[model samples]
Target: MLKIVVGGQINKKEIFDYIQNYYGTENVKLEIKNDLDAVMAMQSGQFDYYIGACNTGGGGALAMAIALLGVTKCKTISMPGKILPDEEIKKAVDDGIVAFGFTASHVEQVLPVLLDAIDHKN
Candidate 1:
């Protein structure tokens, strides 16, 4: 089963709900944490992916993730009004983006695409 850690500075529950709705509890192990805990979990190999949100996409939500996980391992897939294409999202997965960050408003649109990419990878 895939293990994912969902967190952020804001709207974390919404994102976590979307992920649960998409993947279902049986299919993946999900954990809801604060940004710092999420990063720590990822570093400890406790999660397969880290999904987070912030007002800006790359600021508070992902700054710590990137710093700990490395720039190449993290990707900001969406903003308030800008969501990346499915291909781009897939490309990020292909490029080894284990950590994803986006604006809260885009979770509905971004989660499915990101989850799909992760599903295909396995």
Candidate 2:
């Protein structure tokens, strides 16, 4: 099972719904948290991934995550209308990015690609 924590200065409920719809509850355990709680959870090793969003792709949404997990463990997948290529996402996951951040407006494009990369990372 994959454990995920969604947080930040964006719409966490929408992100949560997308994950639930895509992976289903049987395959994943998810929680909606504030940025602080999300960071704390990651520090405690309570989640496999932390997905966060903000107005910009790499702003407040990821500040704490990057701080706690280090910049090497995080990646910004999308920014406003820009979503990275599938191969780029896969490479990030393969390189061990445990935290993903994106713009709120790009969630629809970001989530599916990000999830697919994670699912196929093995």
Q: What is the C-alpha RMSD of each candidate to the true structure, in Å?
A: 1.0, 1.1
Tens-digit lDDT track of model 1 for 1-122:
99999877888888888888888889999989988899999999999999888998888778989888899999999876788898999999988899898988887788888899999997
lDDT of each: 0.88, 0.89
Model 2: per-residue lDDT, tens digit, 77-111? 88876888988998999899999999999887878
> Backbone clashes in each candidate structure, one number apiece?
0, 0
Q: What TM-score does candidate 2 get on C-alpha atoms? A: 0.95
Question: How well does candidate 1 score on lDDT at residue 3?
Answer: 95
